[model samples]
Target: MAKSGPNYKVNGKEYYRVSLEIGRDATGKRKTKFFTGKTKKEANQKKQEYINKQILGLKDTKTLWFAQTFNSWLFEVVKMSDIKPTTFARYEGLYRNYINDSPLACISIDKIEPMSIQRYYNDLFKKQKKSSSQISYLNKFIRKFFNYCVDCGYIVNNPCSGNKISLPKEKRSEAIAKKVEIFTDDELNKMLNSDDCKIKYISLFSLATGMRRGEVIALKESDIDIKHNEIHIRRTIATTAIFDENNIKTKQTIVQEPKTKNSIRDIPLPNSLKSIIKKAKLIRNEEKFKAGESYSTKNLDYLFLSERGNFINAGNLDKTWAKFLKNIDIPHKKFHTLRHTYATKQFENDIPLKTVSTLLGHGDIGITADIYTHVLKKQKEKSVDILEII
Candidate 1:
């Protein structure tokens, strides 16, 4: 490269010399040049400085792959976290079906962009036509995946940002009716003296204390407090079963504990009902002994037991309840209606809301009050009588 002579320009009566120099590329492969302020000295300084800095190896992007980045990111962020088995199964299913085993899953992180994510969502909707909620869930997982890529420097930024779809609301179920199934005193007497001792005890205890079917079945001998005249609601017997993909049985059984913490509570039992439970306990022990087993050998502590002395399932309890109602000729009602009936009866007898709330084991008095608004409306109607008398 050649050095050109300084070119001078006069301005404000002072001469300025602008100079230029040309040099080889800093990589030393190509010829390069520099230009500077009105001096040959400055031009040479800039050219030499540029060449020195380049020789020190300051460079730009070399390699970027989407799939490699995504895979690396997956191993880095998601592999160790504790996620629900069901949730992991679903997410992994999506990955296997659509992304993980596919070509797009391998796209370079730097090359991944919003258009790519938008296209993925479009393809999912086009191919599977998933429900709004399903699409929303898939979109969320993809967004999270890309967010991880961004955090790990695999990608400069998340492509799925600002993409969101709202799911439709699910319809609410109608509330159960609150009609009081007030049996005639004679019917009540007959029911109390029913020959089917198991049904009779269950009916008496349910009606007396207003415990739910699950609460009734989950009762353990130890949970009963004879001195305090109370039944402790510790666990509930609801059945969930594992199944093969063909729906063939893997295993089936009962789970203890009611669905909510509020379901565990203390319910005051009627004296008459307590006597029945005490007698029932003795009968259960005698039956166990007859079967060459000890009552102490009973695995579960539930108050109710099957022939095998295990906690009863809901289906079995329902069948027994239906049979008892039919044999007694009482109005047919769902088993849970017994709980409503109990609460309604308490309200009819003018029990305080707080007391009823506690009896139902409601976490909030407002919830107990809300569920029984129909009963409360009646109470308000009765209040008119007080207004008239006053």
Candidate 2:
């Protein structure tokens, strides 16, 4: 081999090269840095940084590629924060899907371009069944990672930083801003007439008060005030995480306070519902006695419980709810649609927005407004009462 200056040739083009002319050294072994610059001096300087980083047992900032940099960035950036476990796991999934299989993994950091990054997203969107919001979130994550890479001098620019990939804009689906079906008085009465007393009470409570399933399960007898005719909603329970198809423990269940401060408010009870709940509470207590178990506050405290007298899981609630609907031979909507029905009825009856917002534990009136826009539009038109003045 011809010994030469820090310079080399590939075909006919010159590549500035730096090869460490030594064997094993104080750090470990010999290293070589090959780079293409307009000049040999630029290449030599680049080589020194590589050698320097190796000597110090650090990654060379100049030579890190997308694959290597992102791996490092996960630890360097995400691991240091106090992010939720679910959120960290999601970021990991995104990186595995987007950046792991690309040519960008081996492509030198300096060579990445906006066009390549745009294509990555375009491919992901085309291939995956993710929602628009999910894709936007993934894009934001990629853009941020590349921005960090640029700030640290691993790359010249963020390939994804300035590029705008058009995601399909999500208009309101057919269900949105549309008059959703709410149970009429007869329909509500038919559902209330259940053979299973547990299902009957659950239906009555949900319809009258509009508490969510999790919120309903988490409710304590102490949360209800018969004299005031009110039920307080303060907390919710949810499964910790969704598991993979393999049934591994993919996530933990969480029992925490309600999502927003407004979620902690009390709902005024209607006279009809107050009477039903009072009778149901008496029956629930009598069953506890017949089961021959000590009725501790924890066991009997909740308004609803399983036959075993434990707080009912949402799955149990769903199963029981489905069975009730099937036995009654009634058309059904999701559990949430019951709450939606309640809110819609309230809006149609001309109850104020602020009052409905508080009952539903909405974070804001805007969310309520968006969801019940169809109900509200109808109510607004009906408010004129043509016979009053004419």
- Candidate 1, residue 75: the lDDT equals 44
Q: 240-279, model 1: which lDDT tens digit per residue?
A: 4433434243333465556557878888867877678877
TM-score of 1: 0.53
* Candidate 1 stretches greater than 4 Å from native: 1-190, 242-251, 293-296, 384-387
lDDT of all predictions, in order shown?
Answer: 0.64, 0.70
Writing each residue's lDDT as its tens digit, candidate 2 over 1-390 gives 987553677788877765665356688877544555657888767667666656755445545767887877875677567654455567777777766776567776656766666666566556765556677887788788878866765555566665345554345674363555677667666786656477777777777788876787777778888788787787876654443434244655445677667888888877877667667677777777776564444557777666656666667777878888777877776777778888988887879998998899999999888778877878888767778979
Q: Per-prediction TM-score, please? A: 0.53, 0.67
